[model samples]
Target: MNVRQDIHSAGVPVLCQSCEARHRGLCGALEPDQLVELSKTASRHGVSPGAELMGDAEVVERYSNVLSGVVKLTKSLSDGRQQIVGLQFAPDFLGRPFKSESAINAEAATEVSLCSFPRTVIERMMRVSPGFEHRLLKQALNDLDEARDWMVALGRKTASERVASFLLMIARNIEPASDPAARSASFDLPLTRADIADFLGLTIETVSRQLTRLRTDDVIRIESNRHVTVDSLSRLQQRCGD
Candidate 1:
């Protein structure tokens, strides 16, 4: 795994050259012309592992849609304790709109690529594009839904159960382009113990402990640090304490 941190010195900024028109997190109302204009406002870039995208209280000038890789959102307390607030996968939206500052910093959990769009441009385009406002509203609603679901995992689920739910959520969010196997039987583990700890509200030791339990139980096998072969997804789902 050539992590983005080492293989490249500088990242190349790419416009949204995809023929798919709108990327996954688009307001969903953008037309061809609107997309081109939106692309004009966007600049692609990459970040190394542990690189901070938006640090605490950083004014978000642009929002991004992940083209590849994973980003983790986290917040640290005054005592230096950090909590993983969110995990963003490819085709998912990033950045805060209309907010004065980012509540959490987004960091590359791994090497990452992003399509960055200027906030002002997006806001203007949304004003002109058909149904764009509604799409933005819906986007907010969807985010809220995900947050609430994870809140339950954090507040009530067991460690193993939390890991299972996280895996299934990531599986559903991963774009087909990002996963060639698409066999419905296998997927990858893109997060590290530290990453899992933050999102699952457990210690790194706890995450590692539960992962061992999962492996021993025939739930999964570690392909590498960044990959996992799911052996029994039904059983994995059941581990989520469903």
Candidate 2:
């Protein structure tokens, strides 16, 4: 898993003010000097689609804040059945602090960029910085809340509703440097039909039918099998019954 060396920027210390994740992620909790210290150990990485970022039970040596694209958190059973437990978006932190091994497998759902640093550095910082600790705690709670909501969607919602709900979630979350003023948006499906099926707890055929149904009803426009364009956010939300 040797990445291109060019992708690794020399850890020249930098300020937090210009970081994209400064206000939204872990960097938001850091003071000026602390930010510089973090920069010294942090490097940027570009991950290709389908690459395994971390594996279940693997030692956690480093942590990353996702800069762009989607990551799927998966869990496998003893029988080899796999489930997509969760999805992480840009500016979301990855890795478990204070834990030696990962609980789930994290794979890149699309081409992704990350700001990564050693786990020990983050752990040490958390011990001394209450703000950092609070931010991590808040992030954990938010993830828990989202997990609970997904549990309801999977357990109570119909197949079609589940598909619509997934689409709506992506539409709201996936932003790719688009015009902030634009109400309409378009992005490629980061996960394949099979992957989506695993995530939604449906068969591939069921997932295909639901997507076609959405397109036929004019809720969305599809180009290549992977590309999706939503005409209106409100219309998509309405179809999701949200």
Candidate 3:
């Protein structure tokens, strides 16, 4: 990742223009000149896997776009139990708008690169740009919908079904839209087995056993603990009861 320490680049405009999220996320509503202005206040950073982007209960004064990789949103109970509530992928916006602090832990699930700006800047942008605010609202609604769906999965799905459903979700999200013929999808699992257990509301042993069962059944191919290759998304989805 190109670290934007200076917050100014010789080709900032070009860089913003070529950004993957340029037309798909918050920046999509900005005009070319507006992008040029916004780039001046923007900075980019690469976050190592497992690092905290935002801690639970920490004051959040900045906003960011996930330029690449995944981030996990986690929450911990007073009794010390923690759960993985949601996952954020590339091009997703980070930070809660109109709020002063984070309610969940935001951790890098993979090597992540982000483009960030001050929260004040974003709030200001929303005030003047209806299109930008509208986009943010849309994103918020989508995130809420996903969260509710996952809640249902965690509360009602069977163990094997949960594992299969998890895999299907990851496969769908990680697959590139440009690759229509990618009959099989391969990627490293962003979360550890323990983390997966928390996310699926299962025990570590159960998660491992289910994963092995999936591999044995030819629903997936596990090259290593983290490396996973799904032979057929359709089969995985079937296992997920999709």
Candidate 4:
């Protein structure tokens, strides 16, 4: 069955990053019984491409971590102009940690796999588990750094620089560090041109133009419409003004 139906069914014991949990999720600091108890109140959900997990202004009751695929955090103007503020990738956490609702909405950019537990339950556990609390704090700090980085990109970076930086960020996510291969570094790109445009504060056409420029300059090459290969790290970092 698909992810949607699978949540309602009992899953077998999964051996992953943690025998108790994987990917720095709540299971990392909890015992098996603790995980099982939380899972009891928890739910698993799959979202189809473009399906919203939480819309803007809606209070969220659960927290999630991506098991597979991607999701995007976005916001829109009352007039309907939208900006993508964050990209969620596999092994990454999703949803607001300390808040109930956000001004932004989160939606699946592709078919998504998620493990969701009730916020109340998780928060309760945090009060008793210092390790769990520290993990959450670290996650928040990481997100803060990413947000600051975006301010630099949106406020100062040019269109070409924005696209180049975007590619570099995706590559970093897929492989913990940058490693070149076969004259071009390649990795799956989870966002579309429009999403990149939103994140970079540019229109779709501008995003396309920058991508073309990067390709022509041999900074990056698009192996597929959705997959990118970077040819030079120095040039890519130079584009970021780093």
Candidate 5:
């Protein structure tokens, strides 16, 4: 049998066969044999919401693939105040490769699932697998681009636009594979109102006011203060002022 057939028949790890990361994440760059090797040391686990996955200035011993749910990245100031910097969804790599220490705190914004491997194992693979290294570089560049975009949003976007943009971001990332033609989505808000405000650089009251405005305009529907349904993602996108 050929390599592809061999991989399908037995080379691929059973646990990884149906994993989203295997198809969409860094593991996609690895060969079937490499996957089997990696799986020997890899572990799968779940984290509760608000739990810290990694803390700032901590030693970097492992990296993870976000299997499901949202991870919020934050940085703290000297006075212990924190700022929400970014969010990672399923299939996103979850650590800074080659860094000796973590520069940010990674916490579960929602109940999260992860597939993690030791840092030494991953770094060794990167040295030997050009494709794996290339994938890591690509993700890093994509993150930088997103950070720049968010900088613009925070620096210049109006409060209404920022809130809309935040909602649009959550909708797209939460259901990344949803049909574009449908233009609709429903999900529980992963972050609380205070957290959302912090991320968007707005006050909690301002966040609530904008959400109320969106609901009144029929752009979105809110139930139980956390459940949100977007009737038309296109309309929501229009509100983003992009």
Candidate 6:
């Protein structure tokens, strides 16, 4: 009758039967039997905000799926300056494949839930499962496309537009299945103002000023500094300079 019921009827492992990743992420490519086999070594865990899930050049031991909450991907300069390169949301895969060490640092931006499996298990599956490999490729390509779009925003967009675009990106990704016609959305910001400023290549003051402008214009509402409610997604999109 519903998605949960359908998953139950499919007889997948209990751990995966209700997982969003099982339906929309790489696990979607696996058969029920495969899921059962994979679940033998899979583990679910919670990570608090500010926790480092993986570090730059860290030895790869496991791969994970973001079951809930946000993860930030960052790159550091030799001088110790770090840039927020990307954000990962629920159902997104959380590691690099075929690499012995990670190239970027991944940190939890909010209270996060993850389902992790040993690196060898996933790599072995990829070698044997064409569907699994294809799903991974598709995600990689999608990330590349998003990175390119963000490059344009950072390189050419004004401070105001960049802020709007960043907010729009978070709203869209945080709830990928949100109804398009609803034209409204609300969610807590996954990153702090400083992190947002770094991601958008703007000063913290500029980010706050633009956010205040958006609030004054009725494009969005901010509560308690982190929660954001976009009153009109269309109006917000209009400000993005897309």
**Local distance difference test, each candidate:** 0.71, 0.84, 0.84, 0.71, 0.91, 0.91
Q: Which digits, one per residue and each the tens of the lDDT, describe model 6 over residues 107-206?
A: 9999999999999999999998999999999999999999999999989999999999999888877864244466788999989999999999989999
Model 2 residue 71 CA deviation in Å: 0.6
* Per-residue accuracy of model 1 over 130-235 as CA lDDT, tens digit each: 5776766777798899899888888888778888888766665554424444434455666777767777878989888887888888887776665666755666
Q: Tell me how candidate 6 scores on lDDT.
A: 0.91
**How well does each candidate superpose onto the true structure, as a TM-score?**
0.82, 0.89, 0.90, 0.80, 0.94, 0.94
Q: Local error of candidate 1 at 115, Å?
A: 0.9
Clashing pairs in 1: none
Q: Write one digit per residue (lDDT tens) for candidate 2, span 42-159.
A: 8888999999999999999999988889999999888988889999987889999878999999999999888999998999889988998898999999999999989998998888
**lDDT (Cα, 0-100) at 237 in candidate 2:** 71
In candidate 2 the C-alpha lDDT for residue 48 amounts to 95
lDDT of 4 at 213: 86
- The superposed Cα distance between candidate 2 and the true structure at residue 44, in angstroms, equals 0.8
In model 4, where do residues sit more than 4 Å from their true spots?
1-21, 175-185, 231-235
Instruction: Report residue 104 deviation for candidate 4 (angstroms).
Output: 2.1
Worst 10 residues of 6 by lDDT: 1-10
Q: Give the TM-score of candidate 6.
A: 0.94
Indicate the TM-score of model 1. 0.82
lDDT of 4 by residue, 92-204 (tens): 66767678786778998888878887889878878877877777778778889999988988888777777778877777654433333433466777777777777788899
Top-lDDT candidate index:
5
Q: Tell me the TM-score of model 4.
A: 0.80
Model 1 spans with C-alpha error above 4 angstroms:
1-23, 175-188
Which stretches of candidate 5 lie above 4 Å from their native place?
1-10, 175-182
